[model samples]
Target chain A: MAFYDSLFDSLGLREWCGAGDKGGPMTMAELLAKSKGTTATEETSALTLPFPSLDNLHAACEAIPRTRDMTSGVENFFLSIKSSLQFVLDPLTQPLSWLLDGSIWLFIAMPWWLLIGITLVAVYWITRSRASTILVAVTWLFLAFIDHYDYAVQTMAIIFICTGLSVLFGVPIGIAMSKNDRLQKAVIPVLDMLQTLPSFVYLIPLIFLFSVTESKLYGIAIILYAIVPVIRLTDLGIRLVDQDIIEAANAFGMTARQKLLSVELPLALPNIMAGVNQTIMMSLAMVVIASLVSAPGLGVLVLRGINNLELGVGLVSGFCIVILAILLDRVSKATLARVDVSQDS
Target chain B: MTANVKVSIKNLYKIFGPAPESVLEHAKNGVDKASLLDQHGHVLGLKDINIDMKDGEITVIMGLSGSGKSTLIRHFNRLIEPTDGQILIDGVDVMTLSADDLRKMRQADMSMVFQKFALLPHKTVLENAGTALRVRGFKAEEADVEARKWLDRVGLAGFEDHYPHQLSGGMQQRVGIARALTSNSAVMLMDEAFSALDPLIRTDMQDLLLELQKELHKTIIFISHDLDEALKLADHLVILKDGEVIQQGEPQNILLNPSDPYIEDFVSDINRSRVLRVRSVMQPLKEAASSTAGNVDYNDTLEDVISHSDGDTTKVYLVMHEGEPVGTLCMKDLVRALVPRVPSEESIRS
Candidate 1:
């Protein structure tokens, strides 16, 4: 200790010690006096520390305002922005509202059963399995028996729009996150919040922001609720690319842009496609919840059944949702399987 | 062939960190290795590496893992940049080149093959080979034509349409070799290119590389941890240990007389008779024709001498160097050279 003391003294470190004291521990007046090398005058008023004393904690608590709401500004800002967006989108949402309306004329214009048959056949061909194809056909026939086919198509339409939009927006964002560490850090906490939030909670604020009659009101909510898996999986897919492959690309003198296009993205395709499948399934899950905000779907029949205590209507609509889930899951999974085979070969 | 230097590196250093400039500043002030490890925690990948690659010569960098051989070779095409030194391709400093110029140099003057073959998994063999040319802005048809030619050269002519996963390890490596050769770069950097293949396939690949080297005369820098592979292919060998050059010379010279104890230990178990050629040890056949009843090529191995000769006249043979007789060695000398030396009793007891 003495040796260290002498070493510090010889190095003129005592001044640095005092400087550290001023920064860390010393009182402001003491620090000021040390800086100026002067004492306080008799007439100078004493300066008090800003921190409350332990003995006076109860008094401090009593003195502070109880109604000091800290999050008021944040809440107000969010509310205003949401309302303004809804006001701007109201006119643009009219055609979608009319499309959602269940009229005889619209039903006559489109033969519902024929459309169902065609969709089932296309799904069968894509999935390349008779069981899944027949399952889809029978499910649709049951939906028609319960007069929920039209409502089921409405739900499917919403799911198709939401899933397409989710993949389109989510994949690019995921890729961007994979490429940029700072962006990944920024996005991960938000993804965590979205994934953990109750699915029904998504519709609560949107309902206040937009009218229940608009299709996009629920459309936006369902997309927000379901888009997380795709984005996360895409990021994971790209990140999971073998580092050796990346180094090889660099050795080949491929630019960063070229490597991403030719190597990284292609290798990550299976994971990204898996993410898309998850997103589609999630979109289906959110559709029933979105029906609370007047989303026209098989969900409407389920809601009606629940409201009226009709067991048959509820069971039929629930079965219809299951059939749709299987159809989408089969098609997406098959596509992914094909991609993997191609990549392996 | 005229001696043309294809690649030159001078005192290259690579230190990884966020503040490379500050890290380098500290590193220049004679910071000891342990202290640098303590302060910055940088894995000193390559340190003060200087090498020159000649045209049409296969230079092998041999080292254990973490010896910086891969990092050192990667600096040639700017795959990894040197923290301090200059890498010159032809007459231009690659470090100072513009991005476009670097890409052009890599695309036109240099190519690389990786240990894992690094073929694009989704693309067919033809597409993988053609990717470099396509990136270099060649038209699809022209790129395909050139790719097919190189594929044929690597003996995978009919398998162009098969994807990488469809090919065997040997076949995939062939595709990798083809992809590299397709660029038509005078210099090719192969970083343990056949290390992942089975022994038989590895030998075949080595033979293929030798065959390709003969016709193209490409300046090649090969990296390997395997000593035998280095001896088989390298015109010049650089042995690295703990991020420093231990020994560097012709493969025959290094194999015969390693410079230090570390190098000696590294080369100790090597089959010297197989690696050391008669040209390295044989006395010239000037006075030897009258002395010995039989003729032996100066380039034959000592093993060959023992295996081929029969009668009692096999007492001593003169060694040759460049058509001039250099030294004389008898049957006893051959036995002495073949046997490993045992330590004396005092050394053994210690």
Candidate 2:
């Protein structure tokens, strides 16, 4: 540290690197020592550094930045911007809460049989198979028989709202990305972070920004986690369209909009549908985690099961989530297969 | 025949890299293709290309792969913009056309057939054929009626409702041609359109194209890597090597008098007797030669004349065109013309 002091001093960096009181949270060791109102015990080391080590550099030059400082700096920066973010994000996000709440109410108010009938009809229409329709019917009946139909509907409502929003916003973003290299370069890292970042890490920030009572808290968290796949796959799908086919369209003198509509989007449908299926499954996965923020659903029952150690409640609710996922997956996959068949034929 | 020049490309340079403009100077100063790429990290796609495509004739651009033949064809439609050049179509500079005008030009003036067929996989053959019309804002019904005519012309009438994948490769290419024909543009740009077909199918397509060309008389720019295809289809031939025009003229003239070693190499192994037509080697005559073996069609290949002669060097046949004697083809000159003027290089690789 004495060596670093002289080293930094000779380089004319001492003014910034010699301060002791940078206004921020202290390191864990400093915090602990202060809380105990005593200097922490130090063990003398037999081995001595031949030169200035990083620890001594931090000690002897208190202005030298530490890793914690950088993290807390990011935290402080977010805290400063949080109100403006909420101001902008809150009004924009209010409709999402309404959509979620409205869907949940609509699902619940309808008699269970009517909802099941509509769902079965929709599935049968899309898949065009009586066996799949019967399978969906049996699954719904089992949920009702177990008295978890209401909870199951709540989860489906959330997934429906979130996945719909994801596709609605995600698709255009994906299209824009596919059209522009600069935008794709800008979006890809953000998408990568959203995808690979631990789901709860994003929630930590969202929890601070929005209250648990706001439906958008869970909605936003679920969307942030679930939207990545659709956006990624949509971009990939558009990019994967045959260059020769695109050239053919261009040779016909297709305008940009005409080409996108009649050629690119139609060709990319199977991939986009696959993206939606993944988004639905991911939304279902995030729904259980979203229950930690007071999202009402079968997830609530599962959490209650976990907290109270009731194995039966957890297993049944978990099974219900699996059934919902399978229903979504099968319907979407059937639609994808249909598209493929039509294109292939 | 004094045909009007339909499409004229002049002083075109295309350098394929980040800074094509900066490298254009070097290319203009006679920096060859490989060294320019090696020194400046730029690919010389085309260098000072100049060609006049006459109306109502097939101008076959002949080259092996990576010879800028595809690049040149695309420049006509601005699919790949030239680094520097003027493309004059009917005396209007294509490079200076506004975006809307360019699209208008492509829609109203030209259509293309692609090597891989490039048919829209999702669309039925009818819809794919109607693409140019649909893009031009024709309603589906209107486009359908128009497209049906071309599809019928291309011999795919009953297959209108079928998807591209459901058809064989030859059938798919017919749909490609139908799509081009349906556009009804005067210029047809075929970029290796039949290269994907089997050899037998390719010859059939060639015959089909020639038959259609005879009836239509549309200005066509056909790109081919195969010399035989070029000789068969080209009314005017432009040979390319290393992104430069090595030689260009009538295909038979190019065969008779190849100016570059590359062009010479290209024609070296071609079935010379089969490719050389009687009209190319005939001595112009106001009357039939007094010596009489028989009469031969002006368009007949020397192979036909050779068969007619029965290997007799003294036979001379009257070259007939439209039932009139235009010239006389002497077996002695034909036999001498069969030998190469210059000895070809040894071990010509493929």
Using DockQ, give the best candidate's number: 2
**Per-model fnat list:** 0.71, 0.80
Candidate 1, residue A279: the lDDT equals: 91
What CAPRI grade goes to candidate 2? medium
Tell me the deviation in Å of residue B105 in model 2.
1.1
Give candidate 1 regions above 4 Å deviation. A1-83, A87-109, A112-114, A117-134, B1-3, B17-32, B38-40, B284-289, B311-350
TM-score for candidate 1: 0.82
Cα error of candidate 2 at position B182, Å: 0.4
Give TM per candidate.
0.82, 0.91
In terms of TM-score, which candidate is strongest? 2
Clashing pairs in 2: none
Which regions of candidate 2 are displaced past 4 Å? A1-43, A46-82, B1-3, B286-288, B343-350
Model 1 lDDT per residue over A56-129, tens place: 22122322221222244556777879867777777776554454453323543578767776777787667676
* lDDT per residue as tens, model 1, B56-126: 89999999888888888888887777788888878679988888888778888888999988888888899
